[model samples]
Target: SIKLVLKMLDRQMAVIDKNIDGMLKEHFAEKLALFKDFKGVGPCMQAALMGALPELGQLTHAQIGKLVGVAPLNADSGRHKGKRITWGGRATVRTTLYMAALSAIRYNPVIKTFYERLLANGKLKKVALVACMHKMLTIMNAIVKSGIPWNPEHQNVSKNA
Candidate 1:
């Protein structure tokens, strides 16, 4: 009976997921396509982004990062300099971005290389991951703003230049 109940719940969840996907495609097709263009960004991340950050394309990268609570803020006061830390803003968006970043670091070429470079440069693993999350967010923001799909070649050229 317990197993049957679990199976029923799983089927319900699958149906709900399918419905959400259909609704997102129907209502936010363009935005969903933009989000899905990025490597490792899937339907769930696209839905979360579209729902939580309706202003994604309208704001600057720094502004979006700050809004999502991923931007590092200065904690300095006169000569008493302090480490920059991220705080405040929408926790759900931040968490979603973090998950997206984790996947990106594994499968997205630019993200993976950038993450490795940061680690090689002696940055803490968590710090590097956060930086990757911020970078991914910025990339997505720019993509949405410019109406361009994710292009690793373009990103590489810009980085070199």
Candidate 2:
């Protein structure tokens, strides 16, 4: 239901976006006006990011991953040959983040290039996409951490993940 509401809100916003030339005098007009030009990010992704991490403005990358349930958990045991990885966090958050990741690939140049490079390196299609998602979350963490909006030209240096 949350996603549904977001989708509807996005649609309404899109309609308004298409006719923004004459709606510049309303209250909070300046802030609302920015929505007319806010490309790349959409309502659903924005809502998800805000809802999934209300304190995103204060959290670190590790905390963000843990919040979204993407940080792999320990699965080692006495007889296990390898660790058993699993998804044990909020399913909805993970799904919404993944969708946001896909949209970033379409709209964000840095992410799109990284995704293409990964594909060119012979990574499996799904694997490359997930890597793109991970990188996006890391980028988001750094952006929020610095209290700055995303800048495509600024190269993100950390590859620790």
> Residue 14: error of model 1 in Å?
1.0
Stretches off by above 4 angstroms in model 1 are 156-161
The window of 10 residues in a row where model 2 has the poorest summed lDDT is 30-39
Give all candidate RMSDs, comma-separated: 1.9, 7.9
TM-score list, all predictions: 0.91, 0.63
In order, how many clashes per candidate? 0, 0
Q: Say which candidate scores most in TM-score.
A: 1
Worst 10 residues of 1 by lDDT: 31-40
TM-score of candidate 1 against the unseen true structure: 0.91
